[model samples]
Target: MPSDGFRGLVYGDWHFLEETTSKSKDSHVSSNYAYSMGIALRGAHYKVYPELKYDSVKPMLFQKHAAMSINLRNTQPMMLQNVQMKAVITKQGVFSQKRIFSVNNSKIAPNSIVTLPVQWQFDELKPGKYKVQVQVKGENDWNKLPMTWKFIKNIKVDKKAADNINDKIMRKPINKWFYISMATGGLMLISLVELLKLLLTGSK
Candidate 1:
């Protein structure tokens, strides 16, 4: 009642209508109501949280394009709305390119997990440990502040792959500002079977 909170009504087994009070989270009534309220409010920030994991089917990359997957789980009390992700590829700690991927289902129900198949296209990465960083955001009307989570994974490229990418690297780098400004659903995924067919055709 003292803070900017919603008013509550009585809901119980008794027939009489009365205001609701809590001895919540292992507290005794003799200590007064402030103790219980303080504990619950203090833990409010921990109420809404999500889990994220990134994996690559081809961890040891051989060429320009690779297949990876993302596992996202909604472990909170509310439904996650318009859940989306942005992935970036970086070398020497500076990101080279970025792509935004939309979830198949815009609304993720509470306690539900979704696996997104990620197709990465970076023809400029050399033979080294380049980091793939992914950021996920949760959009809901009840979320007053921005909710986001980030995860990173490194991919190794052998000499064969490095040479292939080197031959295809563009002369000028794409401006980072330009990449950020032009946000679009430009990411596309091609199946592994089709990729093999293309490679085999090129060899002929």
Candidate 2:
């Protein structure tokens, strides 16, 4: 006969329980083993963090062009595939016409970080507060499931400043044209003087 401790337990094809109590049926026991295992498996497939770096330290002032840096760091043990990065801009609270930019079907190796450069032209945007969102999506090594992440930032636009910048940019070509015209006129005058001197010398 088996011991009293093992009396209620069956030996064949039986499952093991850490401990048993009189009230075991009424009590609840939770284990994180499944959760940890899931995380471990997913970690081998797809895991990453997204970060955004603006061009300037100060709050962004509205201009003809705005730029930022995007970074993705893979925390997984295996390489990730079909990685896509997309940026969206909203004016006040409304979505812009379309996505600002996107990098599709990229690949990232395990524990590696990637940087993407992005630029937005806001000449048509009015002075106000705008929201910029960056999203990253990718497939795991197994390609069974997809993962997604996002980062957000707020930007302030100043029309006066933007106009000043635009004006300066516009004036540059005009200034160059003016300088070229002046040089051409000077050269023509020199040529005219030389031609007149040659003509007079020939007549003499």
Give the best candidate by TM-score: 2
lDDT of each: 0.50, 0.54
Stretches off by above 4 angstroms in model 1 are: 1-66, 91-105, 120-128, 140-145, 155-204
With a 3 Å backbone cut-off (N, CA, C), the pairs that clash in candidate 2 are: none
Q: Give the TM-score of candidate 2.
A: 0.38
Clashes of each: 0, 0
User: Candidate 2: minimum summed lDDT over ten consecutive residues — where?
Assistant: 5-14
lDDT of 1 at 58: 29
Regions of model 2 farther than 4 Å from truth: 1-66, 91-99, 121-130, 155-204
Q: Put down candidate 1 lDDT per residue, 1-204, tens digits, no spaces.
A: 225432211111223334456556775543322222211122234345444444342222333354334556655444555666666555444545443445533554544565554444554445556666777776642453456778777776676765664565444556988776555323323455678889999999
Q: How far off is residue 177 in model 1, in Å?
A: 38
